[model samples]
Target: MIDTDRTAAITAVLDSLADAWARGDGDAYGAHFTEDATYITFVGTRYQGRDDIAGSHNTLFAKFLKDTKLAHEVLDVRFLGADAAVVTTRGDTYKGEHPKKLTKVQTYTFVRQDGHWLVAAFHNTQRKPLMEAISFRFAPETKPKAWPAQLLDSVS
Candidate 1:
């Protein structure tokens, strides 16, 4: 497949993340990563194991974005080396008549350990979002060539 096609496929994996989280399937959500995956949240929280990630999600699944019928918007996708890539996506967690907006810029490093792209590291943040409405940004001609310097280490 072409790079664009491959990119779309990779993005589909990310889309599933919201699905898993929305359904409150802790095991399914965590299964999307590599065994040694490292995750960093927008609040700078670090989770080393999938257990920690699941535990953390479970704590807020019923309260925040999980109940909000989450949606994602892709901003940019830059490939690093051969098996690494950084993705910037804007998302929203819509709750009861309110959507906790998140301009999530995530760096998803996927490694094809076997034949699937398993997430190695996922670092993301929650940017100030709009109201409960879905904000789909397409043909966005205003992204930076290089990501901001704040993406040095996993903030969490």
Candidate 2:
């Protein structure tokens, strides 16, 4: 059984990240990650270390991502051990109304460091509905059982 308190703590960290992004506070947003964290963006940009993450986000927030808000829903969380966990979430960045369906799937690897859970690595990938539909239709077994069927229904 998973420890409710630990799960809550980990979820809180994700919440904090979203909160920080909503405020466009790059430093606060990066604080949730470990000092040596690795972050891979949907566009394939790789950021190494918390400083790099914060610096790049500062630039993005000041320009491209200005005024954007992050929306995310946790899909699953699995513990690797007492001090490590992997969390999967669907998310998107929006300016006005929250997205009805998040377009990106993200995975975060979190580690307990100095009694606090911090993201050690993060990977984000944009979902391609058409491609998913084709794959699922051709090979039903390729579909992930945990994924909602609606994820590919739109393409069908």
Candidate 3:
């Protein structure tokens, strides 16, 4: 069974990651991963290692985005072992602009190493609400802006 403290720790890590991305703090964002972590984007592009991760962030942030909100609903968190966990979450990014493009639902897998929990793998998928929602209204509530908020947000 997962204790509250462990859960809090996990939450902290996830939050920091989001904060980093939202704030355009590449260092903070990359800090959440292991040295050789594997990151797979929603489009199937894979990047390995901290260097690649850092490079990706550098290239992304260098483009200049006014990063905004990153609100998510943590669907579930399950322990793979004493040092590993899988977190399933649904969320969307909102850029303060026009023609919204949102990608919902992201799954993250983290592993605790040497007393520190680091993300070992990350996989993001676009949420298909209408496909599962018989009552969901297909409405354009607002346009989405990829604000680069997928990086670290808050660790504690």
- Measured against the true structure, the TM-scores of the candidates, in listed sequence, are 0.69, 0.94, 0.73
lDDT of each: 0.66, 0.91, 0.70
Backbone clashes in each candidate structure, one number apiece?
A: 2, 0, 17
> For residue 146, what is the lDDT in candidate 1?
62
How many angstroms is residue 48 displaced in model 3 relative to the true structure, after the best TM-score fit?
Answer: 1.0
Instruction: Estimate the lDDT of model 3.
Output: 0.70
Candidate 1 positional error at 24, Å: 1.3
lDDT of 3 by residue, 26-140 (tens): 7778889999999887778899987788678766765744465456667668888789888877666566652243446678888998898998888878755454333223433
How many pairs of residues in model 3 come into backbone collision?
17
* CA RMSD (A), model 2: 1.6
Scanning candidate 2 in windows of ten residues, the lowest lDDT window is 147-156
Candidate 2 Cα outliers beyond 4 Å, as residue runs = 148-156
* Candidates ranked by TM-score: 2, 3, 1
Query: Relative to the unseen true structure, what is the C-alpha lDDT of residue 95 in candidate 3, on a scale of 0 to 100?
Result: 67
lDDT of 2 by residue, 1-156 (tens): 867988899999999999999899999999998999999999999999999999999889999999999998887789998999999988999998998889998999999999999999999999998898898799989988766555555665
Q: Rank the candidates by lDDT, best first.
A: 2, 3, 1
